[model samples]
Target chain A: MTNNSSGSRFGFLIPVIYIVFLLLPIYWLVNMSFKTNSEILGQLTLWPTNPTLRNYTVIFTDPAWYNGYINSIIYVVMNTVISVLVALPAAYAFSRYRFLGDKHLFFWLLTNRMAPPAVFALPFFQLYSAFGLIDTHIAVAIAHCLFNVPLAVWILEGFMSGVPKEIDETAYIDGYSFPRFFVKIFMPLIASGIGVAAFFCFMFSWVELLIARTLTTTDAKPIAATMTRTVSASGMDWGVLAAAGVLTIIPGALVIYFVRNYIAKGFALGRV
Target chain B: MSFSWMAWTLPTAIFFITIFALIAALGVWEYFSPGGGPRVGILRFETTRGDRLFVSLLGSAFIHLAWLGLGGPSLWWALALSVVYAIGVFRFV
Candidate 1:
């Protein structure tokens, strides 16, 4: 009885410790966000000595900050849609067909995911520049496709492979068209894969500074870029920077929470 | 745009040409070279996955280097190289 109680106690303690570790940086950021620039550097306060929503008010009332949020959301959605649409067909083809070099093709696709993002950032900037698409949400959206597409392909392939090939053959034998079969039959089976892929696309697009910043100037800068504006020689606005950092976590956390149930049983089942 | 482009331009152009020549040479070399599959001597054969991954990583490293040494505008080479490497893996490896 005592051993079991102790074990349960430790189990409870583990999550508490983990949460504290994770929340500490976030807490500090939020704490500073409520303080004035002077108070942020004035002294250490475990809790805000004088809390104010002044920073948040500044962000909300300001045109640039709110506009950035709108632009970020617009492109993130664009990248997600493009990546999933292209990857779904390509993944299904790779999973179902026994083409000439199926194994080689799949590995090649994985290699794209493994490729570092930094390298692609430049080519993307130049490519977009040449096309006169620079400083637009579309430019960042397509540029992100380089990363998101491969990821979507990989996850969808894993989900697709878990499904029995017999199901596909049987469906076709029953006279279902390829598109109908894929949309109705195959999609439901891999719904979780789509969710997981969307999560990744959102996460990558949200946190990504290099491509987001590179592709966008004033008209289409992401919130991550907007965070950098707080730094200056006159003085850093610790309050706004912290508030922005705290706010950045919200989109990602909400995504994971909504998809938390499906994420566990996804993708690790099979690899085609 | 910046003088930094000069830093990698010479080395990068040379590096790319060398890889192009090497891949072609290896493809040709594969035909004439002796027994294949993990040979210590000349014409070695890589598994399909191995060839695809090796070339992809090799290209990625250079792409990453280009991003760091210069600024990040040459990733087309990485993307284009991977596609070619994929073709090689599918066709030859």
Candidate 2:
């Protein structure tokens, strides 16, 4: 009885420890963001002693810094919407039918997700340049589609497969058209899957640097790319860099909070 | 405490951070629901989530290296090929 009790106690400790380990760097970044560059470079304090919001103020006031955030958000949102929209019908078809080479085709879609962004950075740069899309939000959004579409389709397909064929047949018998049934009954049934797919798409596009950086210049530089400006004549601006890092995490955190339940389900479903 | 000697670039740091984050996320997923039971894929061997992830990462490294070895001018197609390889690893291996 004592051994069992001890095991259970340590079970909670494991997850707690894991959570702390995962969050420590983030907490450190936040702490550093609130300190001066002198304080940061001078010593490694556990927390900020002389706290200030100067770094944040700098970012907010600077167009180069703030515009990066805006550009990143625009492309990330555009990519997520486009990926989900394109995947829905494709996912439905994969789930509902078994046409010739359907399995091969479905597997082919997943292959796109495996490609590393670094390998495609130069090609995407050249392709977008050829089309005069080098410095545009759409270029980044469309390039991201190369991977995000496959992931969206795969996740949505897993969810759609969970839904029974009878639902589709019943909807048809009730005189519902394909598009109407898809929007009304079918979509609602796998709303959580859609949520999960959208979340993944947003995250993949958001954190991806190589492709995003290659596709855009000043007008559409992502926050991650703009972050390189910290290395100036003086030295690295550690405080502002830390502040930018904190800000970059906020959107992802908000996204996770909103789709927390669906993400949990996605993990359980083993589709993510 | 002094990480200066490590000479970490932003992208390199971010890459390591992402790998750690993924591992942590996988740990959390395993904790919440323990049974990520091993299943035999097309490779005819049992594998779990972590196993598949490891295989895919290893395979991607080879794909990239092979691309470099072959002196490919454009790596997009190599990347595309790697994607297919990774998907295959996850699905079959």
Q: All candidates' lDDT scores?
A: 0.76, 0.86
RMSD of 2: 14.0
Best by lDDT, which number? 2
Writing each residue's lDDT as its tens digit, candidate 2 over A96-212 gives 985544554676688789988888887677677767888999999999999999999999998899988999999999999999999999998888899999999999999999888
Candidate 1 clashing pairs? A122-B72, A122-B73, A123-B73
TM-score of chain B of each: 0.35, 0.79
Tens digit per residue, CA lDDT, model 1, B11-81: 77888797677556555555565222332212254453335445565766776676667765667765676
The sequence of per-residue lDDT tens digits that candidate 2 reaches over residues B1-93 is 333445679988896897778667766766676655569998788877667766776787788889899898787787788779878887776
Model 1 DockQ, alpha carbons vs. true complex: 0.09
User: Positional deviation of A72 in candidate 2, in angstroms?
Assistant: 0.2
Q: Number of the top candidate by DockQ?
A: 1
CAPRI quality level assigned to candidate 1 from its DockQ score: incorrect
Q: Relative to the unseen true structure, what is the C-alpha lDDT of residue A255 in candidate 2, on a scale of 0 to 100?
A: 96
